[model samples]
Target: MMQLEQFYCRNYRIGPSESDFRSMYRPSAMLEHMQLAADGDLNAMGISTSEMLEQGLGWMLLATDLSILHPARLDEEVSLFTWSKGSKGVLWLRDFILTNHEGDRIAEARTSWALIDLQKRKPLRPSAMPVEVKAYPEHSLGDIPEKIILPEGRQTRETDRFTARYSSTDSNGHMNNARYADLCCDNLTPVELAAGIRRLQISYYREVHMFEQVIIERTDAADGIIWFRGMAADERGTVFEAKLQLNGAA
Candidate 1:
């Protein structure tokens, strides 16, 4: 069991006049929390890698629901607690709780992941989980969420790619879980993102991490809905797909 310790960190940076309480604790901040959790998970599994290799496997692709409980304020100290929630076959389940210094719960997260053969970039059997770790226990995060699907015949509208930055990976040495959100959003127009979102969903077909290049493919948009898919070059064929809902411009 990986214990709750100082997993990872970043000091708060907002002045009283500069930011509001709610905006300060947006989903983006939660990304820091997820990065810490991914670190703990990697440690627990004993598959920890060096910074160089870790970046290639893109750490925990958070295939579950995340709920925010309380708002985190500027200058508040945030910490994370995580543990294995159990797994079904090759799907590994993990849970995380984010809290502030006063012990106030700020947010909760759960994730599902499939181990992949880093070289082949293909899904590996859950039975492949190291013998050192036990199978994920039983629990419900409501109905198991469905994976996001790429729209049929969607072609590349834009192709933006990134090499995992050293900062992108978590303590476990792989690309941090939250970076996926950053990457997904990178595919959108700034105007669309600023308008706000009602819901956002993404699915991980493969783990992406350091040094790998990823290509973003966008679906045709109409109304206020848009879809996208990202692919990385690898022997195994890993893909990341996402669907986004937008708020109309004022």
Candidate 2:
């Protein structure tokens, strides 16, 4: 682990299994690495999951905005840096930067989280936490839109409903955040997938539990961005929404 002035950094060598058909790091794998970095940072701050649970609290992700400039290839070593960007009421913000071995940035992400009461599942104020908030250097992605808007006049199509499997569920008893990327991407057309995703933004609205069937809907905007929405098949409403900006095919 490498420590910057106020950021926690970790090196990850992209594994063969982590690559997609394009031989580049998959979105889900990148998200998993980001989660690890977040865990490491929280642990360094003496607020690990167990510690939070002991205080009757837990962290819940609200949204994440990731921009990929270049994808990491198999066996490539990437450095990931993360830091807390303070909090706004009940919402805590964190940001990450991923760089290649040459030190050129490949991806950047910003995430929002809420501290929740474990039993009640209600958000708690960040000030109530025992840890000291630190002043950290900022790495802004230049106003990442919190909401992804679908272009007017675009047609929406729905995919076959599928259930949340055991393999997709996390300890929280819901589909893992990273798994949502896979689910969303699975709904993309082969052409769109082949074009390669250059950016992704996901907002988690509700938790989808194991065995709950989900319906994925997508709309392709005129600007080449694909917007996706995952709704509960049982009519419980929208569970998650995502947007993918694709690079033109070679």
Highest TM-score scorer: 2
Which run of 10 residues does model 1 get worst, by summed lDDT? 6-15
lDDT of each structure?
Answer: 0.59, 0.81
Per-candidate clashes, comma-separated: 11, 0
Give per-residue CA lDDT, model 2, range 31-121, as digits (tens).
8899889888888877786777778877788898988888779889999988877787788888889999988889989888888887887
Clashing pairs in 2: none
Residues 1-250 of candidate 1: C-alpha lDDT, one tens digit per residue: 4334533333334344322333554454465556555655566566654532454443345474566555566656666666565566666676666777766666666677766666655556755545355333443344445687865666657557677768776554556556666676666676665655544566766555678777777775567677777777564565677766665512
Model 2 lowest lDDT segment of ten: 136-145
Candidate that would win on lDDT? 2
